[model samples]
Target: MPLSAASRPGGAGLDFARVLMEVPHGRLSGTLLVTGDPGGRFHLENGVILEVTSPGSPGVETLLLRSGRVTETDWASAVRSGAAGWRVGAELVARELVGSAELQLICAMAALDGALAMGMGRIDRVALDPEPPATCFAAPEGIEPEWLSRESERRIRALGGQPVSPFRDRLSRTDAGTRLLDDGIAGERRDILQRANGRRSSRDIAFLLGRGLYAVTVEASRLLHEGLVDVAPPALGAADGPAPAPEYGRNPEPTGQPGRTEEASRLPRRRPGTSGITGVLPLRPVSGPWRPPTALTAEDRRFGSAQ
Candidate 1:
């Protein structure tokens, strides 16, 4: 069947962790589609994760190209062959481009990386498709969603120790005298820092760097906690422009008496059934104020009450 974006039944809440657990426990087989920042799909068979794909991370093909293991032409040829019924990984192995074990490792790593990225941000929406696209290749073994959830939890805890959640915040270089490169930063970390323009969010940096969002987010969080970077102020909305200067020398319309009495400043009279505490308390009818009893009744004394 063609891919269709279906909403959750009964308008259920979106919780990545809970979904992961439930899918595996129920031994369900389907593609769990998640939509949001770093949105992705988890392909599972009987609760075992067969594959994962996310916009927030590089795929196996990109990884191979970036690692210089294969040329673009070679990748294209392999893909064409795979689409023609030969498994891409098998084709590459047959062509002596990579070993069987190596291909398996790469596929597993890519799946895990994508899953990690998917777990990093809020899952805004989700759907399950009983039928997923048929592929020429199959994973040597499936990954347990339970394990993925545990690893995700560990990653979250590690990130929680930092000052910021990079996936959710934009970061920019700090003016601190300490330099990132001077501290032996090189390769990916250096590349990430160079792209930290205070305007791009971590997801943007990931796409720019052609790396996994989770990896970039974790590194950005570390850089922030180490004071090598700072969180950028939130961008203002179109309606958030500066307020017009007050009309000087013109008498402003009286919102109230010239000098509103202190009594007027007291909390707005609670709606008949609302509490005096504006938001801290629930909106319920206020009973009479508390008062001490003049004397405890015999019944109260029996219950060990004090007068």
Candidate 2:
């Protein structure tokens, strides 16, 4: 493992950072459509982050309904009563289902978490959308773009690639993992362990359970380190590569079957004394802000194309 985009000046993370900062510096308003797995969009209002949407993270509706804070019937009713096109938050507040301040906080958290989820994956290309849709919930006094970029990076890099991505890594239970569940664990990790049944990614678990993607991924990483859970390989077509065997979660009972399921752990693991957890590597100290060379070329603008 070497320094990644998070640490490398020329990485896509830095490119996005530049874009985020530059757009806000000019006090621009638009949505940045970032392309990648479970790609996301950042809606900016005069350079302030109004909302962010991503498939890798739970949205406001998931946080409301899936968490049991709001019932399906009530939510549907509110949606029907929504005004200003998509302002469901206002309806919820007016109906006394949720508080105005609380709704605002939830909107802010969802947007920031969505940005975090986007940071955990590759960003291929970013295009600006001038007419971004108004969300059902909007964060009051929206987040500043510079702080958004900095904080998002701080959160993502703090994990240091120890966590598997909800977008890329699908989890399954190991024999040990099954035992952990069978022994009757409790709380969020327990729920996460129960759902790591060889099919759901962390995103799926978050949506199903109304948990934040970051929280679920962190717990999954802990389970992975404990040998209680493992990453299932990608589902490739027949022509993709050498036919990889299908990975399945095992029951607590051990069968006389000769092949062990541990071999099915497809994701890479770190070797001792190496930064092999993922792309995370120690960043060299920076003396100043990074700038393109004076002789900027078309190639200089290419963000992580070689990666």
Candidate 3:
């Protein structure tokens, strides 16, 4: 089937924490597409997350290629070898590029980080696109949504108010720290310094270096705090106040208005005897003799009250 779009919101500032929670609450199985400044897809099976893809998170391919675990030729060849799109992980495992446990772990991390990316940005609308992507290195059993959402929310709160967001702010080396930055910089910090050219963001750097987006953002924040990097203006999907709610139990605000009177609001009560029946239950025609329908007596009322 075609990937049709649905559930587009008509209002602004739509928070999709409710929809994200609904997947687990209803035990939904499909690809939940979140669309906004930096939205992405959450692929779930039987309400557990199989994989997730977001601009703020690096996938298995990026992690494998950019980290020099595999070359482009091998990656492309393996992709061609997958006939049904789900065996790429097995293919890599067979070739000894990555262990099965390592692949599952990477898929789980990608899902968690993707969810964090969704919460970090503004979510305009959420819709279920039943069709998942053709090819993705998904975890075999998948991760539970409750655990995934909570952990992602924890990471987001820890990253609160940082100068550099994964997809929002770009950074550049500070002129004042030019000599200091190049003096003894090495490892991840040095790699980030090389990419922080006032154009690319933490998301870009993560894709380029096969590192996690949140880690790159935190390091960039450290650089900014230490007077080594200067951040550019806020990008399209900068983090805002009122972080998304993590739990699925969150209730939406009530939109119904109350009536002025009890009678006005109440439905017509038409239970058993409200129809003015003149006989007791099993009110049927007599077989042998015609008889008048007996009216309710005081004893019957007393018996009813006793019951």
User: Candidate 1 or 2, higher TM-score?
Assistant: 2
- Mind giving the per-residue lDDT tens digits that candidate 2 earns over 96-212? 898866676677667757777666655545667777547667665565566555545555654444657554466888999888788988998789888887756666677778767
Candidate 1 wrong stretches, greater than 4 Å: 1-19, 22-27, 36-38, 82-87, 135-138, 175-185, 238-307
Write the residue-wise lDDT of candidate 1 on 28-111 in tens digits: 787778765456778778766766776555566655665677777887788787343536666777788887666655565566
Better of 1 and 2 by lDDT: 2
Clashes of each: 0, 0, 0
Candidate with top lDDT is 2
* Lowest summed lDDT window (length 10), candidate 1: 269-278
Give candidate 3 misplaced runs (Cα > 4 Å). Answer: 1-15, 82-86, 131-135, 233-307
Q: Rate the local accuracy (lDDT) of all candidates.
A: 0.53, 0.60, 0.58
Clashing pairs in 1: none
In angstroms, how far off is 189's CA in candidate 3?
0.6
All predictions: root-mean-square deviation over Cα? 20.9, 11.9, 24.3
Angstrom error of the Cα, residue 91, model 2: value is: 2.1
Per-residue lDDT of model 3, residues 117-174, tens digit only: 7665555566776665443677765666665655565566556545556554567788
